[model samples]
Target: MALDEAALETLGLGTMWVRRGAPSGQGVVEDEPALEEPRAAAYETASPAARPAAVQSVEAKPVAREPESQSVSAAPTESAPGDTPVRPVPPETAKTIRIAPAPEPEPLDEPAWDDFEPVPPVGFDPAPASAPAARSADIAALDWEALEARVSNCERCRLCEKRTNTVFGVGDRAGDWMLIGEGPGENEDKQGEPFVGQAGKLLDSMLRALSLARGENVYIANVVKCRPPGNRNPEPDEVAQCEPYLQRQVALVKPKLIIALGRVAAQNLLKTDASISSLRGRVHRYEDVPVIVTYHPAYLLRSLPDKAKAWVDLCLAYDTYRQAIPNDKARS
Candidate 1:
């Protein structure tokens, strides 16, 4: 509670009493002076030197307060035991002032965390498992005669539009040894059979060295039956279209062992993009059949130094082919 003006004056501190003198009687307040002058005058002539002699001579102590209802007003009162003098209120000092009740405190703006419902922790789904691709259904169903017929009359790709002839594979149909090349060349396109002209003769000589012969236990075929224009390597789409025919050929021959005669042949036959250098000198599996990669006769002709390596590849193929044969006792 703030000190009353009379209590402050008793304490020797200046009082900010608004009245010019104490209010004298009921309805008898003095005329208002300028508000600024009254506020300024409230502090005047009230410095340390001007303090009342009675207050300055005595030690200060807290004054005891009466209850609000029994508080003294502006009349002089006798001092009680250990009690300081207090002024009494003027008669019926304007009926006790009543303060209004304070308004209820406004609610806080932010919401409490406890007010919200619990949320579930988030989770993620696992990725789908990868699987090997399924082989072509239509191609798998074709037989020797049906496969050959399909390949011959096939206009399945752009190769068909400019094809001189579809070299629908040659050599032994029931051969145990199969060799595959990339596609037809100039002579093979004209002849309607694979391995003709110089490359064919060289292939024949190589077979003779291995004690094998064309149309004996050996079958010669190609990945693409039709020649690519100017003997450029077959485009990916061309190879895709022609792959079904080659797949059918592999199914029909059921060779004891197969040989891939060039980079393109090895890559397409193996269904891989690995280089010939990485693929050669090993027996790799083409589903059930074992395959060996070798330099193509045309390639060997150009790269004559590799002919010795080709012979080594042929030896590996021969060993692989022999291993595929059952033991004599097992066979018996």
Candidate 2:
């Protein structure tokens, strides 16, 4: 027997409890209204659209038992005349279940402070800073000839006191490749070039390997134009004084790629004290231009095995330069 829709509403029940069922031969005890006036009014006034679909009520009467084959958890019941479907009393019921959430996990056992090494925060530089990365407005504004003349006679630092000739760099003023070295070596100071002597020869071979000649399509320069005493690395003041000249050179040449040779060259150009081992095989930026790092030709002359690694860095620079092209083409 299926109960009328109005009867289900009056009994504070929903369609989920009003499923069709086989007749219960046993007669219903009472058809008296189950809900009092207040309850019936609440159920009637609640909009049908707002009601839950799956609720039921049990009367104080025996529901027909499910077939023996049915599971105890899902026993089916029969309906009596003038009543909605009846169901068996639930064996176990939960009026409400309150579960406290699991507690926050305790932090794992930390080792003693001595067992761990300290890590500096990101961008934490311990090295003493050199002078401001000062740019010479004068240098920035000078044309090629004026800039070259200024570098040749530059006496701005102690290096100028001892250098034989100021190596004013050589190559295409408007080319797309620039080479920066640390400072002038003995051969460089004498010959007025960035890379010369045996190192210069090795550099020439390396450039030919990439099909770029020294002054043909590449501009070669040093961090400081003058040689440091005894070919020592350029001092902080020397590099600081000369940075503007190099910056101007970069601004003028507008190279697609800048290859920094060795540790001193890499660190000074990048404004860091990091070693070449960490800097190599990676592309850094000089402002917006791409800079690649490699072993100095002088270092390669002594450590022949590193020549292979230098070759790889050059290849990376070549590939990067090709990518900078408007259409992925690089000048030879």
Candidate 3:
């Protein structure tokens, strides 16, 4: 029987547990109270706007059974006369439900120290990962002359003060290939062009082996404009500050492929600390362009044994470039 609204409000029970059920068997009679005390109180105290409509309670009672039937676990036998409803004994009297709370999902196995590789530091002075370059999103629409002008006058970091000139990129603005190095070296800083020394000469020869010309078809830039003191690795901060110009240049040039030379360039562009061995010969996407990684020309010079691997990387780059271009346009 459904409880009257007055009886429902008088009890303190909330209506959250209110549900309707049908008879289970022949001897079982379902008794519903006006509302359980807990359910009534819940609804009475609930905000008027949130209260549900028509709350009720349901309980099961067993009628007198056959003499041989001795199941004490069944519902309490019989209901009260008239409007009275039957109530089950408190659950404490009932058997424990044995609800082992899903065994608090075995604490994840702690990774072994050796299994956890160190993360490369995320912050750097001058050029931080926190601040990306500010430039038009579209590279093809950028004004290269204006970009070069800005790079020349850029004082975004202290590197500008240490440099003779901002080794802004030089070569075909419409080039299909882009070369990115760690930053300006002593020779590059002096000449105000990327890759002009022994390493640059090697790079030129490497390009020629693929029939690619430096000033005619390939473009070059560095991660930083100024040389680090004593030719140390350019710190993360330095790259962060100078990357905006490179990002803008890459966007403007829209090269079909980018070759990130050495660890610094690879790490900076990929935001990864993976070893060069792990990175080499693999292709990665830089914006819409395909990026091929190889040993830096300098490193190849130092470790001559790796030059053969560098050649392989170059071949992969050439193949990837060929794949990226339409067959009809591949010759061009």
TM-score of 2: 0.58
Kindly list the per-residue Cα lDDT of model 1 for residues 167-276, writing each as its tens digit.
98888888989989999999999999899999999999999988999999999998899999999999888888878777778788778889999999888878799999
* Candidate 2 residue pairs in clash (backbone atoms < 3 Å): none
Per candidate, the number of residue pairs that clash is: 5, 0, 19
Q: Which prediction has more favorable lDDT, 1 or 2?
A: 2
Q: Which 10-residue span in candidate 1 carries the lowest summed lDDT?
A: 23-32
Per-candidate TM equals 0.58, 0.58, 0.57
TM-score for predicted model 1 compared with the true structure: 0.58
Native-to-model Cα distance after best TM-score fit, residue 153 in candidate 2, in Å: 1.7
Per-residue lDDT of model 3, residues 117-215, tens digit only: 866586644545333432323323448887777778877776776777678878998888999999888888888988887898899999999998887
lDDT of 2 by residue, 89-155 (tens): 3322226668999999999998988877888899876544422322376678898899999988888
- What residue runs in model 3 are displaced by over 4 Å at the alpha carbon? 1-142, 327-332
- The ten-residue window of minimal lDDT in model 3 covers 17-26
The lDDT for every candidate, in the order shown, is: 0.75, 0.77, 0.73
How many collisions between residues are there in candidate 1? 5
Candidate 2 achieves a global lDDT of 0.77
Q: Cα miss at 219, model 2 (Å)?
A: 0.6
